[model samples]
Target: MLLLVVSDNCQNTLPVELLSEVEINVDCSNPDSDDLIGYIERTYVVQDAEGNISDPVTQTITLERVTIGAIARPADIIFPFDTISCSSGYATDEFGNPDVSVTGVPTTIQENYDQASAIFDYIDISVPGNLILIGDDESVDVDLGASFPLFDMTFNVISVNTNGFISTASGDAVPDSECPLSLDPNSLANTNGARIYALQDDLSADTTEDALAGVYYEYMTESPILTPSGMLTGVSIFQWKVDHLEASGDYDLDFQALLFDNGEITFQYNEIGTEMGSEATVGIQSFAMDDNTTPLHATTISCNTPNSVNSLSAVGLIPPTMGGIDLYPFPEGVSCNGYSQYNDQIVYTDSCMTKILRTFTIGEWRCNDINERYFNQMIDIMDVEGPTMDQLTDITVSTEPFSCEANVLLPAISPDDDCNKADIVIDIEYEVGSRIENAIGDVIVEMPLGIYTVTYIATDKCGNESRMSFTVTVIDAVAPTAICDADQISVGYDPSFFTAVALDNGSFDDCGPVTLAIARTDDPGYPDLAIFTDELEFGCMDIGNTYEVALLVTDTANNTSICTSNLMIEDGIAPFFADIPEDITIDCTEDIDTYPFDNPTVVDNCDLPDAFTVSLDTIDINLCGESMIERVFTINDSDVSDVQLIQINFVNQLAVTGTIDDSPVEGCDASDAPAQTTVSGLVELDGDLLISDACVELTVTSSDASTGTCP
Candidate 1:
């Protein structure tokens, strides 16, 4: 194993076959102490089964670097992590007997340190340190260790960590006239028969020991002392002489003390009761009148007229103004006798002393009231102040859907008061029409929609009150309206084409910005007809039927309204007339002069001849083979118009042959035909049609027996 030894002169290294725990002694930094400051580094060399040395591992120990001088130094502090009774707790020689010290490595190390170990290298004991006594004297440095004999300082032992770091340095102090002295129960109950104890100047919590071994106490009471103006003042004076334990031994005398009210040092003297100021002070008298002890003697003692004292037990006095100081702080298991109210009070009367001076000169004796003197104690209550409320701002909110209740929000309000914020009481009130039925928090409240004035009042225990008001407004709500109408339209025995919107005058909203929608709610009047959105196509529909249409309208608030109208229908249709006989063929073999004619038929919805009028526009009967005729028809209904058509060929007659008597009639002549036929016996159609009035004639042929006109 590799072992490193460090010293102030130099460092040394060596490899050893076997090694146990290595111990290094480090010296403190104090100049007066005979110790060295150094460290030893240890490295473990691993060996295999064959006894061969392997890789070696090493650990480093760091030196403790402590700050010294005016900087706030980390001194030894004892928390008394557990409770210990005063009697046996202070019996231990040091602060913590058998205390637990640093033995293992800390989970984390300080940033300045390169490596860590359970043991420390160097410790700078000269870096000023303190010795603390739990609740006793203020922390005092270890440099004053030489003065421990003067103060009778004592301790069992000090616990140090494996790293040589100490968190607590506790010890007992020697009793003296100055510092580290206190009253046991600091406060005294104003009621009858209240008493307090005193603590030794030494920093020990041993209740069985009394530091005031040669001290004695006396009680006195008197009426108020008046000023030159006889102002009915509240001041009184107390005088006392010095006393001693032994003739030639040193003793602490001429000490100063302050009076208190409800654990607070009293501020005003003459202005006692309700007239006391924020702060006040009393003087401690040091004028010596006589010498009672040998080495040093306290002569005369005086103080400001008004002060607080032990108890109210004298005859004509104000209950003797209850308050007194004993020897030790009230113990945990001890009773306060008749002063149970001040049981847990801890009084450090040493804080009140301004100064303590001692002398070895002997003095002449004139008077001796060393046993007792007179001091005034007053019975006064502390003055209390009231609280104040801050200004409150206004609030506004909107109502929830379909509800009359308005949702209001109030900001946080904090009041300034002598009492705590939680102690201040808050009250809210709403005006007549706006009462809150329910409240979610300090801010959220449910109330009817209306103009309302809210009052917020805050109060404290002192009866001081403050108020503020705000207004809340709620709005009105309503809906929109829709109107639609179906136009009255007339058509023949057929569906009509029209727009529903055209017939509609649109819609109206109570509030503005409304939406309108149109839909055809009419029954299927005709399967061939389709009602497409705003437009409709007139197809096959029942002649005279009325249809109903519906329109839907909605407002921005989602309020809907529907309106409807009717569609009127009628059937006044015109007749349909078509000309069939465009051409008529006639043969002149059966000669005839005149032909009978029949008119084309007309069709109407009623199928009545009287319902329409028909006429042939034009007709021609001549010897020619072809003729033209024009026809016209009119409907009798006033709502419909007449329909008429024209055909070009009226009569198609041809004169092919003539009889012997009618062979070549001279009166009728064949003009266009190449071979001429004379006269016509009868005009008849060969295939298609022949009109009665359709007539044709034949001219004379080449040979004929009978002359003259063929008849």
Candidate 2:
């Protein structure tokens, strides 16, 4: 609606209608784009040291405002009461004569111009002048039409109702000449009742072309055929229904139909001789048809059997009140959806039977007829007593007057905000009168998995009581299962352990969470004990160690469900520098060779062993107190006997504290004198080995053939 580019330094103002969006492209390399730099530096009216509330600088030439408008028309008329009264839906109060000088005048003008038009106004802080709206350089001045004219031209008033729709004639207490009516139509100032009508072209319904006279209901009489003989009136509707359709295979359609003047009629179900049932429908048709055909728009109601028109797909629950199933939820848009108040009329049954009456008032707008009515059918389901923790509740039901599935029982725990709470137990003593024909199995029924009835009586000194019963049943079911994609993943951390997590397929039995137990089979320490309250948590496993992840899932009936695997660990990681001998001091400066050193042991805990690959050796060069000697030795790989590093720290057998080469290398025998025994092939090591003032060379070699030392 407005272009809101505001700046703190510039005067604040807004054009109610945006004209254009201006954008300056900075090449970042061009000097002509200096305005782009200033644009970024300029502070806006909504910008502060804290934050920016204004829209980001969104400037482009293509952005512009489009104009839209709505129009209104004014009118004046005269009434036949000698004074005109405004009757448009907007004019709530009547206005009398404004000027006393025209006291005899009967005409009046009624126009609500405020809401019938559009407006745009704002206060400007930039300049002391009226704002100008520029549309493509064409400035539209707001002051040009500061005040709007009441009407464009003079017009005559005339009524056009109760006749034809085609018209161009106009008038004021007279019709327009363009539309030549045989005579003048009725108007507010005219002698008859007539008003202009707006044609509804979008609607498809047929409306009365002319004014309707009247409507009445009547009855016919053949004997006394005269002027309005019966004066037909009070067209009434009839309705009825049955108590137990499966008992006598009949409908007890006892109805209470209200008619004209709050009158009523009760239609008793007289179909006691009718056996209305078939293989398809448990119940058959009734008085739905009149004169061999059903009334207009009348629907049929029947007790659904298998494969019938009103087929019962989901009837009462199978293990009715046997399994621990919760209550049913209310349908959408119903007043009972979350109705937590005790004053509410509805009650959910133990067998999950939602006992409710979807009642409604059918009106003329909905029925569209004089004698119209609506009927509500009763469906056979589990008794709507209340909720129960367990299906078979042991209670004392009397036998005074017994009605099958009468929704009679003890109180439930509660359906208060806490959904997890179970039902409550109470003293349920009842008197029931039985129907011999409706007796299912026996007075002492043996129910497999559902809530059953056991009739009995407990009368001491008081009078005899009616038939009573107790509900009993059996239980215990299978649990659920879990599945993972892979049997086992190797612990070599591609950093992926959760990706291989086992999933609960939730293949629960009819017992549901009861028969199920969840746990982590990988670690025996973590076990899921609770039914629905259990969850398996698996900790992270790394690459070095092999792991055995597992799960122990079972049902309430103690069914063992398990899945496990053994994973292998990975090898080959980056090798760190284990050890290198610290200070090796050479006493004399000779050839300065023989760089023989051993490495410290490289240990790791990665489940698997690590092998070392020696790289190029490092050597430090010395250039002090030198006789200017250049020493180097070419030792071949073939000359090296041991590939493994040797830990040689001691110098001699006597602990004489010499060097490592001083150890026994040449062979000595008792047959020969120890004093005469000599060392041979004593050579120096290679490389620039020196310790400042000391440097020596020695290369020790061993052979079976010995010779004397020549140092």
Candidate 2, 1-711: lDDT as tens digits: 235555554435432223344344323343223323222122223444444345444333321211111011111222211012112212221232212122211111111111111111111111332212111111111111111111111112221211111111222122212221112122123222111211101111111211111111121122111111122233222111222223332222111111111111111122212222222111101111111211211011222222222111111100011111111121222221121100112334232232322221211211111211222222222221222222335743322111122233333222211111233222232333332222222233212333445443322111222234456333333333544323433332334443223333333433334232333344445544432223332222354455554444554545455554454444333323344434343333322345554444443323224334344333333333222222212122222111222222222212112343323344453223222123332232323221121232333333333456534
TM-score of each: 0.26, 0.18
lDDT, candidate 1, 222-295, per-residue tens: 21322222223222111111112211222222111111111111111111222111111111111111221111
Q: Which 10-residue window in model 1 sums to the lowest lDDT?
A: 104-113
Best by TM-score: 1
The list of candidate 1 runs beyond 4 A from truth reads: 1-477, 489-503, 508-550, 555-558, 564-566, 570-614, 619-626, 633-711
For every candidate, C-alpha RMSD to the true structure in Å: 30.2, 45.1
N/CA/C clash count, model 2: 55
Model 2, position 101: C-alpha lDDT score: 23
lDDT of the structure predicted as candidate 1 = 0.33
Candidate 2: worst-modelled 10 consecutive residues by lDDT:
311-320
Where does model 2 exceed 4 Å of error? 1-476, 483-552, 560-566, 571-580, 583-594, 605-610, 617-711
Q: For model 2, state the Cα shift of residue 617 in Å.
A: 4.7
